[model samples]
Target chain A: MLKVIAQDFIRHEFLETVRPLYQELVEKTRQEKECVSYHLFTDQKDPGYFIFIEEWPDRAALDAHCQTEHFRRLVPLIDSYQTREGTFLLMDAFSAAADS
Target chain B: MLKVIAQDFIRHEFLETVRPLYQELVEKTRQEKECVSYHLFTDQKDPGYFIFIEEWPDRAALDAHCQTEHFRRLVPLIDSYQTREGTFLLMDAFSAAADS
Candidate 1:
């Protein structure tokens, strides 16, 4: 499985504006058959720091997600509110046992 | 729910030493009743970067995890191999709708 950790630091002032967009994207993405899991989180200490922990079956599935309507429409809007460029960490489960 | 993203940048030479310690922790943590999920991942682009994505029912449950025998035994040994200090991001789900 391919796991992604997408981290963003949004401007404090744009929290209200950005949240609904995230919700819309998340809800829509969850319906995609390729998505194993999709979750949105905010740092407890720094509310503006957002993280999306996602799981996909493979790179093709993830690539397909990027082309989805919600991703194309909402991601750029969300990017405009960022304090800095977001970080995307593509990861693999550390062990076969951990994959379970 | 409490979600934690624990990131570590391990020294290159210590990857072998650290991997087993992390596996031990992950396996044991998954057996804990309070642990909703426990996963270990290594950045695909940076093998030395490790991330632990964990979920707990509440603060008390998370605290109890810290006091577990496996955690106490493995974490410090794992820490010793880090190139720099690890990052611990305590986070909350961004929305109630996203919780499922």
Candidate 2:
């Protein structure tokens, strides 16, 4: 299995404006065939910042997600209120045994 | 081996306010025996937002990291910031196959 983790920061005030749209996109992402899990989180002290953590069965699943129409359609909606584009600046995948 | 993924977001302006300190903490984390990788990324379009992605060998290693003095000392320094407190908000761990 391949696991992917991505992060992005956003303005605090933007949370109110983007929460609804974010929920829609997350719902769509969660439904994807390869999605193992997906979620959103906000900083407790810093309300402006938020984070999204995702897990996929493999790179192929993640790649397919990138090509989906739902993913494509999200950009414009995200751009309207976002001050900056989120970036997957870090990427790593490797085989391993379960730690437990 | 167990892979741990964590995500947290910070405001754009706060990015600068905390970059130096963040880098120090990350450096300390990377030196831990179980760390496979650690990184920080800023939004391409948004100056105020940033993310930290981490990978650890297992829960034991990750737990030890939390107890380290560097980790302990980081709190008060981080608390001095203006807006909100950062949160680990999301954490996931599992074994995996290399998806090359």
Supply DockQ values for each candidate: 0.55, 0.05
- Tell me how far the alpha carbon of residue B23 in candidate 1 is from the true structure, in angstroms, after superposition: 1.6
RMSD of 1: 3.4
lDDT of 2 by residue, A32-73 (tens): 878887766554444444456676776788889888888788
Candidate No. with top TM-score? 1
Predictions in order: lDDT: 0.90, 0.58
> What would the per-residue lDDT of candidate 1 be over residues B1-100, giving only the tens digit for each residue?
9999999999988787787788788889999988999888899988889999999999899999999999899988988988999988889989743332
Model 1 lDDT, residue A50, Cα: 94
- lDDT by residue (A1-100, candidate 1, tens digit) is 9999999999988888888899899999999999999999999888789999999999999999999999999999999999999999999888733322
| Whole-structure CA lDDT of model 1 | 0.90
TM-score of chain A of each: 0.93, 0.73
Supply candidate 2's per-residue lDDT for A53: 63
TM-score of chain A of 1: 0.93
